[model samples]
Target: MAKIAFILLCHKDPDAIIKQAQSLTAVGDYMSIHFDARANPEHYQKIRDALKDNDHVTFAAKRIKCGWGEWSLVQATLNAVEAAVDAFPRATHFYMLSGDCMAIKSAEYAHELLDRRECDYIESFDYFDSDWIKTGWKEERLIYRHWFNERTQKRRFYWMFEAQKRLGITRDIPEDIEVMIGSQWWCLRRRTIEWILDFVKRRKDVMRFFRTTWIPDETFFQTIVRHLVPAHEIESRTLTFLMFSDYGMPVTFYNDHYDLLLSQDFLFARKISPDATELRRRLGVLYSSDGQRFQISNEGRSLYKFLTEKGRIGRRFASRFWEKESSLGRERELLIIVCKKWHVAKRLLERIRQMTNIPCIEYLFNEDSCPLPDLGGIQSTMGKRHRHRRALMRMLFDYYDTDRLIVCMDPANLDLLEDFGRDRSLTRILEIECHFSDEYLIGHAMRVGLAGDRTPPETIQRLLPTVRNDMTHESDRIRDANFENFLRVREVDPTDVSARAISEFLTVPQDKAHEILSHDHLYAD
Candidate 1:
């Protein structure tokens, strides 16, 4: 059983911090908190008392006076790291989070992801001229000296920073190390953290240089880890969601943000307001100790869409993959369908086979939803839990390269099919309606088998009771199907052996055969 240690950097709002600590107990067994030394003693004791009964929570002995964009923040984080590692020596992962952070995914889901991947999750990037983070990666923060500001001297250093930037008097970082920058929030393997601590101790020059730098916390871990290990060993993604507003200030989440926060596949989210009453209630249910599967509910999904459109959330990594996959399968010329009923699917396949020699693949689609839904929106659909099967359709298209059309089995999802159809490149993807009922399909199968040499008429006749009972047990939609949708896509749905031929082959009277063939009610495929 792999465990994780959390180094929680806490500030004001002791109640919020305590609630966050309790929430994290579900995922991380060991938590070492580092409160800002400037935090009021009254509130600090409140936090300590609230979490005193929580065996998982511990506090860092050495608290530092942390400043925004200052080296003290890094030291405070280091203190928490040391405390957490000492407390949980066997822990596999060490994660850094803020007191305002809350988990969104189930502990089981998060643990499974970390355990199976066995890679460090750090969001680091080699610095570029155009890169953002105007503070550290830029030369002014590195080359020029900056004094810590008094609370009264707000915006006092703004001019000095500007003057240095205009002077173009830049000093280059050490040639031996490449500069990197990324989000500070990260989950690293135990060995990665150990390696980092040892690496910094050995490199005194690197350590002293960063001490004078602005907001070194964001760059320190990333630079150290990237320099020591192979790039492939790192998963360069922080599984935490942080919201920013138009002017780049973090939005203080309230009751309205309750659903949007949980929609992300991320394990945690940050910068939540302590006063968000409704959000706290929702979080209590989601992070309850009872240990539910923790799926994103339908409301959460809708809020995700609303926020995404309004630019509240950033595009996810899956969006890039989907962009690349969208252009593929355009050259394919065959159709595939994953159906609800295998028996009905076989009959449909035979009908398609009769229409043309063109190959059609029919897979028995499952009823389960995807554990991790694709950002493609089509996969994580709510109504029918067709998410897994939808993913299967994409995989099959990739494998079969037979992309003429993929008939979605769930007719209620017509709008989604329409959305895909609107894309010119996905013209081959379309909704297909087949009008065969389970009873009719079963009868056709019986007739076909009766005509074949493999099943003698005696065998078919003997199984009459079983066949009738099986047909009777089929659901209303299956038994009452009229086969109207078949004619709509008649080009692909070839006419099977005529009713007259089947009736004669099975020794059924002509008038009864005509009535079965002439049936008009239809069901969507």
Candidate 2:
């Protein structure tokens, strides 16, 4: 296993820092801590006591006070790096975290990813003239002409200005270079750390340039690494939060906002607040702990329970409506319902199929499908509601073809079908009736299949025409007036089998013969 040295830069809030450290320790990873000299001694002692038994942690030689827009922070970070290197020589990577950020993934997974990305993962960028700088010094004019004019704050201002003069703003102002904004917290390969330390030591000119600059902590590493190795070696983006602020202090450490880190394929969520209890419960169903790290669990009891309960409820509801619709002598046919999850499509299809012998096809995006309660009604009036509907529609289109009658359970789903409904040539026909439940669709498909021989042709012909007419009417409404306030409906292609079927049955053209079809050609392919 690859070793990762987690370095926590601490100031105040010892309790939160201790909890964060304990969480990481529980996962079996190396940890080291540096307490800022400005911190209260009592709090520092408490922190030290908390880690008495933890052999991985150590105290640094010197302390530095870090402030916003100050060079002291960079110096403090460099000191921490030197301390970590001295203590953990065998570690492959050095991860800089804050006292507040907690570990969200198992130590094992983090180690594996670090080993894979052998290159430095820090945020680095090249300097350019367009970069924003607070100082007037260009590459040629390093010393500010206004330094002598300032009397009261002369000491501080003069020191900064004279440092910039010695450094010379020419040959690219490294401090002004824009690095991609990312989480300041990072895991960097040992080679990257060694290179940065070496670069800073050899280049006093560059050091002088950064000495007077504001927010040097943010720029120092980015500028140095970019100059040492090209931009590609360093990941332009960080997996940590960059702009997070809590209690008026800019959160510069990873430990501060552990919960907010985005989950990528490489990371598994290890810890969550009880406030996120529901999400934790869901995540737990998919993963288990191996004493050291969390891994995929084979047992799916929770998932099975959810699916069974939902499936049962859906079946019962469909049976109530199936009896009333049976008099129509309509037989169910092969039905395919495509959505983002399989459990929903499965439960619905199973319930309706139990009533009749119709074959059902279900497709889902996520591998671990858990049952969820049906959202009582569509909520597309809100912007978030509409965006979610669009995403589901895109997923559906990407996964399934148009051969099946797509019965969207919610209005958002219905609105998605409306897009294709405009061009009736699509193979997927959408049904948006309130009665269109999973069980209803299943029962309808089964009844149609079972009545294959008994149903009269006149009944079939009459039923088909009625369904087609209803769909055509809805399609007209979707295309004509601006239903944007109610549905935010977008147009879809007529070439789809569902659209084509509805168009042919309604005597509408497969191509754009009508004015409604040509109104918005934006999505036309």
Q: How would you encode candidate 1's per-residue C-alpha lDDT over 1-525 as one tens digit per residue? A: 657788888766677777777776755567889988866688889988888887788889899977666778788888888887777787888888886677766676677778888788888887565365643246556776555431212235566666667986556676788877789999998898888878778998888778867768778887888898789999887888775432233444556665566666677777554555677767754644445554564354355446555554334311211232243233333233323344444454444334332334433233333232232444344442343433334444433212343332433333343344433333332222334544455465566463344666666566665654543443223223332222122223433434444344223465544443443322323
Worst 10 residues of 1 by lDDT: 316-325
- CA error at residue 379 for candidate 2, angstroms: 35
Off by over 4 Å in 2: 127-183, 242-288, 291-525
| Global lDDT of model 1 | 0.58
Each prediction's number of clashing residue pairs? 3, 33
Task: Name the TM-score of candidate 2.
Answer: 0.43
TM-scores, in order shown? 0.53, 0.43
- After superposition of all CA atoms, the RMSD between model 1 and the true structure is 25.1
Q: Please write out the lDDT profile of model 2 over residues 1-525, one tens digit for every residue.
A: 667777778775677667666656564556677787755678989998988887777666678765434566677888888888888788787877765344445565666676666567765433334343333433323223222212223345567667756876333454544433223556677888889888878878778767755455656676666666655667765544332111111212112223233333324322233233344434332222443444444222243245444544243111111121211101111222333222344444444333322223333222212221112222223443344543333222212211222333322244544443343223233221222334333334345473355567566555654554554565455446443222221233333543343343323355522322233322222
**Cα-based lDDT at residue 206, candidate 2:** 76
Regions more than 4 Å wrong, model 1: 26-28, 134-137, 150-170, 288-525
